[model samples]
Target: MAGVQDQLEIKFRLTDGSDIGPKSFPTAASVATLKETVLAQWPKEKENGPRTVKDVKLISAGRILENSRTIGECRSPLCDVPGGVTTMHVVVQPPSTEKDKKAAHLPKQNKCVCVIL
Candidate 1:
Protein backbone atom coordinates (compact mmCIF):
# COMPACT_ATOMS: atom_id res chain seq x y z
CA MET A 1 0.00 0.00 0.00
CA ALA A 2 1.19 3.49 -0.81
CA GLY A 3 1.90 5.64 2.22
CA VAL A 4 1.61 9.37 2.81
CA GLN A 5 5.05 9.83 1.32
CA ASP A 6 3.71 8.60 -2.00
CA GLN A 7 1.30 11.51 -2.27
CA LEU A 8 2.08 15.08 -3.23
CA GLU A 9 0.63 18.29 -1.87
CA ILE A 10 -0.08 20.87 -4.52
CA LYS A 11 -1.43 24.38 -4.57
CA PHE A 12 -2.44 26.38 -7.64
CA ARG A 13 -1.19 29.93 -7.65
CA LEU A 14 -3.57 32.25 -9.45
CA THR A 15 -2.66 35.42 -11.33
CA ASP A 16 -4.27 37.42 -8.54
CA GLY A 17 -1.83 35.91 -6.03
CA SER A 18 -4.44 33.63 -4.53
CA ASP A 19 -4.09 29.92 -3.90
CA ILE A 20 -6.62 27.16 -4.43
CA GLY A 21 -5.21 24.40 -2.33
CA PRO A 22 -2.59 22.45 -0.54
CA LYS A 23 -4.62 19.41 -1.51
CA SER A 24 -3.14 15.99 -1.44
CA PHE A 25 -3.23 13.97 -4.63
CA PRO A 26 -1.92 10.62 -5.63
CA THR A 27 1.07 10.65 -7.89
CA ALA A 28 -0.94 8.64 -10.40
CA ALA A 29 -3.31 11.56 -11.04
CA SER A 30 -3.02 13.15 -14.47
CA VAL A 31 -2.45 16.83 -15.14
CA ALA A 32 -5.73 17.01 -17.05
CA THR A 33 -7.53 15.78 -13.96
CA LEU A 34 -5.86 18.49 -11.91
CA LYS A 35 -7.06 21.12 -14.37
CA GLU A 36 -10.60 19.85 -13.96
CA THR A 37 -10.27 20.17 -10.21
CA VAL A 38 -9.02 23.69 -10.66
CA LEU A 39 -12.01 24.57 -12.78
CA ALA A 40 -14.34 23.12 -10.21
CA GLN A 41 -12.69 24.87 -7.28
CA TRP A 42 -12.19 28.22 -9.01
CA PRO A 43 -13.38 31.15 -6.90
CA LYS A 44 -16.80 32.42 -7.90
CA GLU A 45 -15.74 35.98 -7.14
CA LYS A 46 -12.91 35.93 -9.61
CA GLU A 47 -13.58 37.45 -13.01
CA ASN A 48 -12.34 36.12 -16.33
CA GLY A 49 -12.01 32.57 -15.07
CA PRO A 50 -11.40 29.72 -17.45
CA ARG A 51 -14.44 28.64 -19.42
CA THR A 52 -13.03 25.28 -20.41
CA VAL A 53 -10.33 22.79 -19.51
CA LYS A 54 -8.45 23.76 -22.64
CA ASP A 55 -8.21 27.29 -21.34
CA VAL A 56 -6.27 26.25 -18.26
CA LYS A 57 -2.50 25.96 -18.30
CA LEU A 58 -0.41 24.71 -15.39
CA ILE A 59 3.17 25.87 -15.11
CA SER A 60 5.79 24.36 -12.83
CA ALA A 61 9.47 25.01 -12.78
CA GLY A 62 8.95 27.46 -15.64
CA ARG A 63 7.52 24.78 -17.92
CA ILE A 64 3.93 24.11 -18.85
CA LEU A 65 2.52 20.83 -17.70
CA GLU A 66 1.10 18.54 -20.40
CA ASN A 67 -2.37 17.06 -19.91
CA SER A 68 -1.17 13.59 -20.78
CA ARG A 69 1.50 13.63 -18.10
CA THR A 70 0.88 12.24 -14.63
CA ILE A 71 1.53 14.26 -11.48
CA GLY A 72 4.44 12.00 -10.67
CA GLU A 73 5.96 12.67 -14.07
CA CYS A 74 5.39 16.40 -13.73
CA ARG A 75 7.20 16.66 -10.39
CA SER A 76 10.15 19.03 -10.43
CA PRO A 77 12.96 18.77 -7.98
CA LEU A 78 13.32 22.52 -8.05
CA CYS A 79 9.73 23.05 -6.94
CA ASP A 80 8.64 19.80 -5.35
CA VAL A 81 10.39 19.69 -2.03
CA PRO A 82 10.25 16.33 -0.28
CA GLY A 83 7.72 17.29 2.37
CA GLY A 84 6.77 20.79 1.30
CA VAL A 85 3.80 21.80 -0.80
CA THR A 86 4.42 22.39 -4.50
CA THR A 87 3.05 25.57 -5.96
CA MET A 88 2.18 25.63 -9.65
CA HIS A 89 1.14 28.74 -11.51
CA VAL A 90 -2.24 28.60 -13.20
CA VAL A 91 -2.72 30.61 -16.36
CA VAL A 92 -6.18 31.03 -17.79
CA GLN A 93 -6.10 31.92 -21.44
CA PRO A 94 -9.35 32.18 -23.31
CA PRO A 95 -9.61 30.51 -26.66
CA SER A 96 -8.43 32.79 -29.42
CA THR A 97 -11.11 34.43 -31.57
CA GLU A 98 -11.11 34.27 -35.35
CA LYS A 99 -9.65 37.74 -35.53
CA ASP A 100 -6.76 36.74 -33.30
CA LYS A 101 -6.17 33.57 -35.27
CA LYS A 102 -6.14 35.45 -38.58
CA ALA A 103 -3.72 37.99 -37.20
CA ALA A 104 -1.36 35.26 -36.05
CA HIS A 105 -1.19 33.80 -39.55
CA LEU A 106 -0.52 37.15 -41.21
CA PRO A 107 3.01 37.39 -42.59
CA LYS A 108 5.40 39.84 -41.03
CA GLN A 109 6.73 42.56 -43.30
CA ASN A 110 10.32 43.72 -43.00
CA LYS A 111 10.00 46.90 -45.04
CA CYS A 112 7.83 49.85 -44.16
CA VAL A 113 4.56 49.98 -46.11
CA CYS A 114 4.25 53.78 -45.82
CA VAL A 115 4.70 55.74 -49.09
CA ILE A 116 5.13 59.54 -48.92
CA LEU A 117 3.42 61.59 -51.59
Candidate 2:
Protein backbone atom coordinates (compact mmCIF):
# COMPACT_ATOMS: atom_id res chain seq x y z
CA MET A 1 0.00 0.00 0.00
CA ALA A 2 2.88 2.36 0.71
CA GLY A 3 4.23 2.18 -2.85
CA VAL A 4 0.87 2.49 -4.51
CA GLN A 5 1.57 6.05 -5.47
CA ASP A 6 4.18 4.88 -7.94
CA GLN A 7 2.11 2.11 -9.39
CA LEU A 8 0.12 2.34 -12.58
CA GLU A 9 -2.96 0.40 -13.58
CA ILE A 10 -2.60 -0.87 -17.11
CA LYS A 11 -4.50 -3.14 -19.45
CA PHE A 12 -3.73 -4.29 -22.96
CA ARG A 13 -6.49 -4.15 -25.54
CA LEU A 14 -6.04 -6.66 -28.29
CA THR A 15 -7.25 -6.23 -31.87
CA ASP A 16 -9.97 -8.79 -31.23
CA GLY A 17 -11.54 -6.73 -28.43
CA SER A 18 -9.95 -8.92 -25.77
CA ASP A 19 -7.93 -7.66 -22.83
CA ILE A 20 -4.95 -9.08 -21.01
CA GLY A 21 -4.84 -7.23 -17.75
CA PRO A 22 -5.72 -4.41 -15.45
CA LYS A 23 -2.66 -5.11 -13.39
CA SER A 24 -0.49 -2.84 -11.34
CA PHE A 25 3.09 -2.15 -12.27
CA PRO A 26 5.80 0.05 -10.89
CA THR A 27 6.68 3.09 -12.91
CA ALA A 28 10.17 1.71 -13.37
CA ALA A 29 8.96 -1.24 -15.41
CA SER A 30 10.28 -1.24 -18.97
CA VAL A 31 8.13 -1.67 -22.07
CA ALA A 32 9.97 -4.90 -22.72
CA THR A 33 8.82 -6.17 -19.35
CA LEU A 34 5.23 -5.46 -20.29
CA LYS A 35 5.69 -7.36 -23.53
CA GLU A 36 6.89 -10.39 -21.63
CA THR A 37 3.86 -10.24 -19.40
CA VAL A 38 1.66 -10.04 -22.46
CA LEU A 39 3.31 -13.10 -23.94
CA ALA A 40 2.81 -15.01 -20.74
CA GLN A 41 -0.87 -14.11 -20.40
CA TRP A 42 -1.73 -14.10 -24.09
CA PRO A 43 -5.12 -15.63 -24.84
CA LYS A 44 -4.65 -19.29 -25.66
CA GLU A 45 -7.64 -19.28 -27.99
CA LYS A 46 -6.34 -16.43 -30.11
CA GLU A 47 -5.03 -17.30 -33.55
CA ASN A 48 -1.75 -16.12 -35.08
CA GLY A 49 -0.43 -15.09 -31.70
CA PRO A 50 3.08 -13.75 -31.20
CA ARG A 51 5.72 -16.36 -30.49
CA THR A 52 8.17 -13.99 -28.81
CA VAL A 53 8.46 -10.64 -27.13
CA LYS A 54 9.88 -9.12 -30.30
CA ASP A 55 6.54 -9.66 -31.98
CA VAL A 56 4.57 -7.60 -29.47
CA LYS A 57 4.06 -3.90 -29.98
CA LEU A 58 2.35 -1.60 -27.51
CA ILE A 59 0.70 1.64 -28.38
CA SER A 60 -0.34 4.20 -25.79
CA ALA A 61 -1.35 7.79 -26.12
CA GLY A 62 -1.24 7.37 -29.88
CA ARG A 63 2.46 6.56 -29.77
CA ILE A 64 4.25 3.32 -30.36
CA LEU A 65 6.30 2.70 -27.22
CA GLU A 66 9.83 1.50 -27.78
CA ASN A 67 11.11 -1.59 -26.01
CA SER A 68 13.82 0.40 -24.25
CA ARG A 69 11.38 2.92 -22.80
CA THR A 70 10.16 2.71 -19.23
CA ILE A 71 6.59 2.93 -18.05
CA GLY A 72 7.23 6.23 -16.28
CA GLU A 73 8.50 7.71 -19.52
CA CYS A 74 5.22 6.88 -21.26
CA ARG A 75 2.89 8.71 -18.88
CA SER A 76 0.77 11.19 -20.76
CA PRO A 77 -2.39 13.16 -20.22
CA LEU A 78 -4.05 11.43 -23.15
CA CYS A 79 -3.81 7.93 -21.72
CA ASP A 80 -2.42 7.99 -18.18
CA VAL A 81 -5.27 9.74 -16.48
CA PRO A 82 -5.00 9.75 -12.73
CA GLY A 83 -6.53 6.74 -10.96
CA GLY A 84 -7.83 5.44 -14.28
CA VAL A 85 -6.81 2.26 -16.01
CA THR A 86 -4.50 2.97 -18.96
CA THR A 87 -5.38 0.97 -22.00
CA MET A 88 -2.57 0.14 -24.40
CA HIS A 89 -3.35 -1.35 -27.75
CA VAL A 90 -1.44 -4.55 -28.48
CA VAL A 91 -0.44 -5.60 -31.99
CA VAL A 92 0.99 -9.04 -32.58
CA GLN A 93 3.07 -9.59 -35.69
CA PRO A 94 4.83 -12.89 -35.80
CA PRO A 95 8.36 -12.96 -37.16
CA SER A 96 8.59 -13.91 -40.79
CA THR A 97 10.33 -17.14 -41.67
CA GLU A 98 12.62 -17.72 -44.65
CA LYS A 99 9.75 -18.90 -46.84
CA ASP A 100 7.61 -15.85 -46.05
CA LYS A 101 10.50 -13.46 -46.55
CA LYS A 102 11.25 -14.89 -49.99
CA ALA A 103 7.62 -14.82 -51.00
CA ALA A 104 7.31 -11.19 -50.06
CA HIS A 105 9.93 -10.18 -52.63
CA LEU A 106 8.18 -12.07 -55.43
CA PRO A 107 6.10 -10.09 -57.94
CA LYS A 108 2.36 -9.84 -57.56
CA GLN A 109 0.15 -12.10 -59.72
CA ASN A 110 -2.04 -9.31 -61.03
CA LYS A 111 -0.79 -6.11 -62.63
CA CYS A 112 -2.53 -3.34 -64.53
CA VAL A 113 -0.96 -2.00 -67.74
CA CYS A 114 -1.92 1.22 -69.45
CA VAL A 115 -0.65 2.81 -72.71
CA ILE A 116 -1.65 6.11 -74.23
CA LEU A 117 -0.96 7.18 -77.78
Candidate 3:
Protein backbone atom coordinates (compact mmCIF):
# COMPACT_ATOMS: atom_id res chain seq x y z
CA MET A 1 0.00 0.00 0.00
CA ALA A 2 1.08 3.57 -0.67
CA GLY A 3 1.11 6.26 1.96
CA VAL A 4 -0.69 9.58 1.62
CA GLN A 5 2.47 11.25 0.45
CA ASP A 6 3.28 8.30 -1.74
CA GLN A 7 0.06 8.73 -3.63
CA LEU A 8 0.46 10.26 -7.04
CA GLU A 9 -0.30 13.91 -7.38
CA ILE A 10 -2.46 14.24 -10.45
CA LYS A 11 -2.89 17.63 -12.02
CA PHE A 12 -5.24 18.25 -14.92
CA ARG A 13 -7.55 20.82 -16.38
CA LEU A 14 -11.18 20.49 -15.45
CA THR A 15 -14.20 20.89 -17.74
CA ASP A 16 -15.10 24.13 -16.02
CA GLY A 17 -12.17 26.02 -17.49
CA SER A 18 -9.89 25.91 -14.48
CA ASP A 19 -6.51 24.40 -13.73
CA ILE A 20 -6.49 21.94 -10.82
CA GLY A 21 -3.35 20.43 -9.53
CA PRO A 22 -1.57 18.38 -6.93
CA LYS A 23 -4.54 16.15 -6.25
CA SER A 24 -3.13 13.44 -4.02
CA PHE A 25 -4.95 10.18 -4.37
CA PRO A 26 -4.18 6.48 -4.52
CA THR A 27 -3.11 5.01 -7.82
CA ALA A 28 -6.25 2.88 -7.85
CA ALA A 29 -8.48 5.93 -8.15
CA SER A 30 -10.91 5.60 -11.05
CA VAL A 31 -11.43 8.08 -13.82
CA ALA A 32 -14.97 8.51 -12.55
CA THR A 33 -13.61 9.43 -9.16
CA LEU A 34 -11.30 11.97 -10.69
CA LYS A 35 -14.21 13.35 -12.65
CA GLU A 36 -16.19 13.72 -9.44
CA THR A 37 -13.30 15.54 -7.83
CA VAL A 38 -13.22 17.87 -10.78
CA LEU A 39 -16.94 18.50 -10.48
CA ALA A 40 -16.60 19.28 -6.82
CA GLN A 41 -14.27 22.10 -7.70
CA TRP A 42 -16.45 23.24 -10.59
CA PRO A 43 -17.88 26.73 -10.18
CA LYS A 44 -21.32 25.72 -11.37
CA GLU A 45 -23.41 22.66 -12.03
CA LYS A 46 -25.77 21.62 -14.80
CA GLU A 47 -29.10 20.06 -14.05
CA ASN A 48 -29.19 17.70 -17.00
CA GLY A 49 -26.45 17.33 -19.53
CA PRO A 50 -24.16 14.78 -21.07
CA ARG A 51 -20.70 14.47 -19.57
CA THR A 52 -18.01 12.31 -21.04
CA VAL A 53 -14.28 11.95 -20.36
CA LYS A 54 -13.21 12.54 -23.93
CA ASP A 55 -9.80 13.57 -25.18
CA VAL A 56 -8.16 12.23 -22.07
CA LYS A 57 -4.48 12.78 -22.69
CA LEU A 58 -1.66 12.29 -20.25
CA ILE A 59 1.29 14.64 -20.09
CA SER A 60 4.43 14.29 -18.06
CA ALA A 61 7.75 16.16 -17.83
CA GLY A 62 6.78 18.32 -20.78
CA ARG A 63 5.99 15.27 -22.89
CA ILE A 64 2.77 13.60 -23.94
CA LEU A 65 1.98 10.41 -22.03
CA GLU A 66 1.38 7.20 -23.92
CA ASN A 67 0.59 3.57 -23.05
CA SER A 68 -2.06 4.61 -20.59
CA ARG A 69 -4.63 2.06 -21.71
CA THR A 70 -6.32 1.52 -18.38
CA ILE A 71 -6.94 3.19 -15.02
CA GLY A 72 -4.17 1.09 -13.57
CA GLU A 73 -1.86 2.19 -16.31
CA CYS A 74 -2.85 5.74 -15.60
CA ARG A 75 -1.83 5.31 -11.96
CA SER A 76 1.12 3.08 -12.40
CA PRO A 77 4.03 4.02 -10.15
CA LEU A 78 6.45 3.04 -12.87
CA CYS A 79 4.92 5.83 -14.87
CA ASP A 80 5.14 9.49 -13.84
CA VAL A 81 2.62 9.23 -11.02
CA PRO A 82 4.51 10.45 -7.97
CA GLY A 83 6.66 13.22 -6.56
CA GLY A 84 3.99 15.86 -7.07
CA VAL A 85 4.60 15.69 -10.78
CA THR A 86 1.79 16.09 -13.25
CA THR A 87 1.26 13.21 -15.65
CA MET A 88 -1.83 14.38 -17.49
CA HIS A 89 -3.05 17.48 -19.25
CA VAL A 90 -6.78 17.50 -19.80
CA VAL A 91 -8.64 20.14 -21.79
CA VAL A 92 -12.14 20.71 -20.56
CA GLN A 93 -14.17 22.81 -22.96
CA PRO A 94 -17.84 23.16 -22.22
CA PRO A 95 -20.42 23.61 -24.95
CA SER A 96 -21.51 26.96 -23.57
CA THR A 97 -19.38 29.68 -22.01
CA GLU A 98 -22.39 31.06 -20.19
CA LYS A 99 -20.52 30.99 -16.93
CA ASP A 100 -18.07 33.55 -18.24
CA LYS A 101 -20.54 36.40 -18.29
CA LYS A 102 -17.84 38.94 -19.12
CA ALA A 103 -16.90 37.17 -22.35
CA ALA A 104 -19.87 34.91 -22.99
CA HIS A 105 -21.40 36.86 -25.84
CA LEU A 106 -18.11 38.06 -27.24
CA PRO A 107 -16.96 36.68 -30.52
CA LYS A 108 -14.06 34.29 -30.69
CA GLN A 109 -10.91 36.29 -30.98
CA ASN A 110 -7.32 36.31 -29.79
CA LYS A 111 -5.88 39.01 -27.61
CA CYS A 112 -2.29 40.03 -27.20
CA VAL A 113 -1.51 39.71 -23.53
CA CYS A 114 0.59 37.67 -21.20
CA VAL A 115 -1.16 35.39 -18.76
CA ILE A 116 1.03 34.54 -15.80
CA LEU A 117 -0.36 31.04 -15.60
Ranking by TM-score: 1, 2, 3
lDDT of 2 by residue, 2-117 (tens): 58768999999999898999999999999999999999999898898999999999999889999999999988966577788999999998788999989999998877888999
Candidate 2, residue 116: the lDDT equals 100
How well is each residue in 1-117 modelled by candidate 3, as lDDT tens digits? Answer: 347554667766544545666567665666666655655554455342235444343444445444324345454445563465654555444555557885867798877889796
- How does each model score on lDDT? 0.93, 0.91, 0.53
> Which 10 residues in a row give candidate 2 its minimum summed lDDT?
75-84
- The sequence of per-residue lDDT tens digits that candidate 1 reaches over residues 38-98 is 9999999999999999999999999999999999998887767887899989999988999
Full candidate order by lDDT, most accurate first? 1, 2, 3
Clashing pairs in 3: none
How well does each candidate superpose onto the true structure, as a TM-score? Answer: 0.86, 0.83, 0.44
Worst window of 10 by summed lDDT in candidate 1: 1-10
In candidate 2, stretches whose alpha carbon ends up further than 4 angstroms from where it belongs are: 103-116
In candidate 2, the residue pairs with backbone N, CA or C atoms under 3 Å apart (3 or more residues apart, or in different chains) clash, namely: none
Best by lDDT: 1
